[model samples]
Target: MSCQHEESMHLESISQSSTDHSLVVPQCPDDLFVVSQAVKRVKEFYAKHGEIKESHGWNHIQAVCDHTRKALLALDYTIQDNVVVEIQLAALLHDLDDKKYFPNTPPGEYPNASAILKEFGISPEGSRKNSYEKIILMISWVGCSENGNTVPKQVKDTDAYHLLIPRWADRLEAVGSRGVVRCYQYNQEKGLPISSPASPRPQNEEELWAKYATSDKLQEYMDRGGTSKDMISHYYDKLLHIARPPKDIVRNSYLEHQAESSSKDLVEVCLRYGKSGQVDKEYIMSLS
Candidate 1:
């Protein structure tokens, strides 16, 4: 596959880096420096690599950040300003070194992420430095389940330690309308077909896995001795569970709507043929 590293993301600068921290309604200063710095670094890293996938790219992080803040306001959970900053930072940098984009890289060992954070002076002894690392690791859904890995040192919340607020907030994207779009966009962008009729199988299974296997979720399929050689099987195995009606992990009304609508989107995409629309309409009709 030809990698396009020269395209510019035109990512906006971290403007929220200078807000007033005490303000509770709109934006806060707490995020201005840390979150802004992290966001800046994220875009810079992707700009350098140029092989970004839509599913796990800077845009995805931005959406996660938006959803995180929306969930915070909608839920009205009493969290400190400092903690909110950490959560926001995690949401922004969650996929900096996602396996999907960096197949050979391991979670928690993402050099680009580490370098950027370190560049921003996110040191081990910094107040929220350690907290940021833990939050980032929590987003490692693959690492958490595959090898029984865990972030032992956690945040102050005893009630929602493992299931942290940001954890849910960030994941809000994976199941809703946005998530559905991202899933299909991911396949289209990669030129990977969702089904036989959607696009012809690539001649290189070994190469395909090389890129797709980097995703922690897909890596799990291989780790468990699973034989799902294609991406659509991923939806059958996991993505469908992200939405509501058929499932219900989202706890708030806003997220509930997103999840409900996204599931419908998933079905719509399932019905869609990829680059070429050569689906077996007669067989599809038979199923109905």
Candidate 2:
């Protein structure tokens, strides 16, 4: 199928899945207002750049919004009106820099995208002003590591977690699994080691074993007919790998034991706190 056709089909599938799962909430009055204003701002920004393709343009925003809404609902979290609006705005305009400023090249080679958002009047001073900045940061986070300081760990976790679900479900089926296997085969053919085991090492042996042990636990979850929630939980844990150190320090202090006694289970310990701790402690603290 053509790229346009594939994009349309993907959007249709997302819409149908979202509806079937009762994922799309009717917009509250406040949410509607924010969405409308954001939509107008996004439209105007894109218009100045010339004709924008829907698949590569607005529909991408729709997909992200749909996935994000479903994720929030699944977590039994209240979807605040402004939060949804901000997330939508971020999703919509995240790629604007790629489309306009970079065009043929990648956005990372240029200045930060948040600066461009500010230039486009998307970052007008108010509570909503920071929304644009947040979105720009998320875009950069996914695109490149350099200018991703503004991308909160929460936003990154939200985006990555949502993107992984459909794939997880799809890959659960035989055909999809075969497709993934085939892709791996192709990668191997192209000189990638698609299934190589890690070389044995003595350094950090305990930490390495702890990592494998957690992987075993996740595999056990999958073996026992794991639901999407289980998978999401696992993915969330994986994302929190960096947050474990401070938590370990604190937990060790609490136990009146040296940090050395704490099992060097980096992934599990890190995942226990997840992205929230990573953001507040690692990201924001670094900024200060």
- lDDT per model, in order? 0.50, 0.38
| lDDT (10s digit) by residue, model 1, range 71-186 | 55545245555555656666666667766677788534766556655666664567657765655565554232232222233333354442343455454566555665665567
Give one digit per residue, the lDDT tens place, for model 2 in 1-288. Answer: 543334334434565565533123335545455555555655566666554443234444444444444433343233344454445545544556653335575534423335454554556476557766555544544431132112336635664333222221211110122222322233334444322123112234454346533434434444544322222233222212212223311222212121233233323323333422221123212321
Q: Highest TM-score: give the candidate number.
A: 1
Question: What is the alpha-carbon lDDT for the whole of candidate 1?
Answer: 0.50
Lowest summed lDDT window (length 10), candidate 2: 167-176
- Candidate 2: where are CA atoms >4 Å away? 1-27, 40-55, 99-124, 144-288
Error of 2 at 120 (Å): 12
| Per-model TM-score versus the true fold | 0.64, 0.36
